[model samples]
Target: MTKFIVKDIVDKFGYDVLAGKDGINRAVKIYGINRPGLELAGFDFEKNNINRRVILLSNKEQLFVNTLSEKVKKERYEYILNENIPMIILTEKFTDKILLEIAEKHSCPVVRASNITTSRLYQLVLEFFDEHFAPATEEHASLINVFGKGILLRGKSGIGKSEMTLELIKKNHLFVGDDRIIIKQRNNRLYGQSHEMLKNLIEVRGLGILDLSKIYGLQVLLDETKIDLVIELIHLDDEQYKSIDRLGIEYKYIKILDTKVPIITVPVTYGRNVSELVETAVSKLKLDEAGISCLKILQERFEEYSK
Candidate 1:
């Protein structure tokens, strides 16, 4: 989990370290005072420990710092922090004395931002938090970005997921995470990205780590994807008898962060165009999003004709 502290924002935003220089690099924890709406959405508002959740403050809004006494500060800090909130974001250009005192007493890092508006600062903070504390999910597959949606493909080690991705590259899909996909939960949405080390490298059965750019050229490799869809490939079973959705009746869910992503199961049978079927599924998903469904539409038309 990546925690955000005021110091982290200052360093990233090029603000001068005012008071809590020591705490500047400390872990970020969520605080109760972040947003009222966030609390309603199931986030603990009062917890004060360094975790993935980051508490952002804006100095421009004019908080009542003068009315806050040392005793009051300590009491309020303890009161809200008991709820398990993370770091505190100070938007106001605060004095070094106040920052130092907060750091020493509460062990919470305070950050200062100059020249940037509160809204812009909030966006930067959110982005930082999202990247820092991405959730942990098992990575048995590779994810790529086709058009704009994130596509996750899974198969056995030797089932040619990477090879299929190579073919999709010819169809103009962008590259994303390969081998391992890192998912992060932000405000409840799941975002996926590729690992830094294994990115753009695929392992074949006989060959070791092969650079995708060298083999398939620069166009074949991608940096990251969001994981909008999950595709699972399995060996064909006759007697085993698998039940697939002929009417798209079944839906599969893959939990990335706090959200569940749509999944499609594709059986890898001989003499079938697996890659093309996956592509068709992708297109079909898009159409489904637009309030269109071939099966449903056909059924409706038939009912109307019968009427």
Candidate 2:
């Protein structure tokens, strides 16, 4: 399980830990952030729901808490201050001794948020957790930026994938990752990147590992990219080459996580310039995305003439 604990938040945001130091290691259950409202009124607060989330208390919650009767207020504080919550963040430096006392009594982590607006803090923390809790996987493929489109190249070993990558990089294209790509699915989209140790590194057959950043320049390297397309390279015989799709009407995809990325199957024959083919494939993808299809245009022209 992905363990995003209270200390993780403290480390990420540099928030001052005000109280409840003991509960720092409690993992944030992947539920999400919560702003206590009904719970603040000492009503309908579910332990299972609120206990797993990181609580954010801003100006509105504090003002609402001020209106509660002392009996209800004490009850509310004691009831919501359950054990093992990730942390309660007080935004805009809002602090209360009573709340801190309750939090300390139950050992719930409370952090004083930095000098950022509550909404911006919410956005920043939510984005962090959303990405941290996202589903991820690794692929035995190379990712490159071709014409601003992220294309993942996959095939058997020694099939000229690396050579094609090197060629593409030489044409001023950016190299995202080679040999292995770490992919994460966020908000129904797949993002591809290289492992930190393998960043800007590509291996070629008959040649040792090469750092493209040092060889070319750091500008040739990309930290990450949204996976826009996938290319499957295969060795094809004469009959297979003849069987290739002549029209650009056939649509294909490769599934990664829950997202389906558009895919192209290109046959790699001897002496064929795979780099140019990749560039052409991406160019065609760009045209297709813009609703400009050469085949569609030709079909319309032929139909008009026949009519």
Candidate 3:
């Protein structure tokens, strides 16, 4: 997303100024395929100058125009060189000599876009921006980051995943992914996504669909979150799998992109206050990392009592 002044475009492309000096120095942004910010492909009018019309040099947005006659192509090229178009974006490869001549003569910036399909290129570009612009740390699972960690609430969809997130939001925690988290791994970092179908909206079994942004006043919902933990809710019962309050075992790993992430499981039952339990689990994990294990502490205290 490098910013280019109109003069920069002209000076680089080798196009002759056929018209307005008003736009000559006006600023524009050029996205080249090889650049970090311009990794996407597509014909975008979204950010175009209100007064300037972008002239796409490629035929049908294709990188190469094989359908046109060589003579016609040359004529088009000459026409472009002589026109006062704001900027010219090149897709097809041209010899450096010709390109240099055009640049030297016209002073128009020569930018080469990737050869991918316009739609795909645009998608890639958008995705890149989205990932690059995401926040550094996310505190909640409802929002997903581009790293592909789907922190989902896996307890029957109604066990207050969204509600708990709303509470977490009140605690000033950033939201990342929600109800339907779409996880994808890019460069080994786990990113999470809110399914487009459920974006900014949460479904509470008996309560139906709720707009988190509206109810929470726009501070609650986030576009995505980087998932490092999975908080699973379980109904407490006389089941064999009930977790004990002991330092017993540690580090439950949830598999995503073949990577194992630490998992924290919390049990829920009537009148037990599940959300508070989850918050405690999160806090305990943090303490565990700092070498303060609650279970281990309890065990040591018990052994001292026995002594």
| lDDT-superior candidate, 1 or 3 | 1
In order, candidate lDDTs are 0.64, 0.85, 0.53
Between prediction 1 and prediction 2, which has the larger TM-score?
2
Candidate 1 residue-wise lDDT, 89-136, digit = tens: 555654425434655466555556667777777777677655665556
- Per lDDT, the best of the predicted structures is 2
lDDT of 3 at 169: 61
Q: How many backbone clashes does candidate 2 have?
A: 0
lDDT of 2 at 186: 84
Candidates in order, TM-scores: namely 0.73, 0.88, 0.52
Point out where model 1 deviates above 4 Å.
1-8, 29-63, 66-110, 216-220, 238-241, 254-258, 300-307
Candidate 1 global Cα RMSD: 5.7
How does residue 55 of candidate 1 score in lDDT? 50
Model 3, residue 33: distance off in Å is 8.4
lDDT of 2: 0.85
**Candidate 3 weakest ten by summed lDDT:** 34-43
Any runs in candidate 2 off by more than 4 Å, and if so which? 48-51, 238-243, 301-307
Q: Using TM-score as the measure, which candidate wins? A: 2
Give the lDDT of residue 118 in candidate 1.
Answer: 70
Writing each residue's lDDT as its tens digit, candidate 3 over 134-233 gives: 3323223454221223344555445667676666666666555566666666556666767667677766567788776777666655675656677666
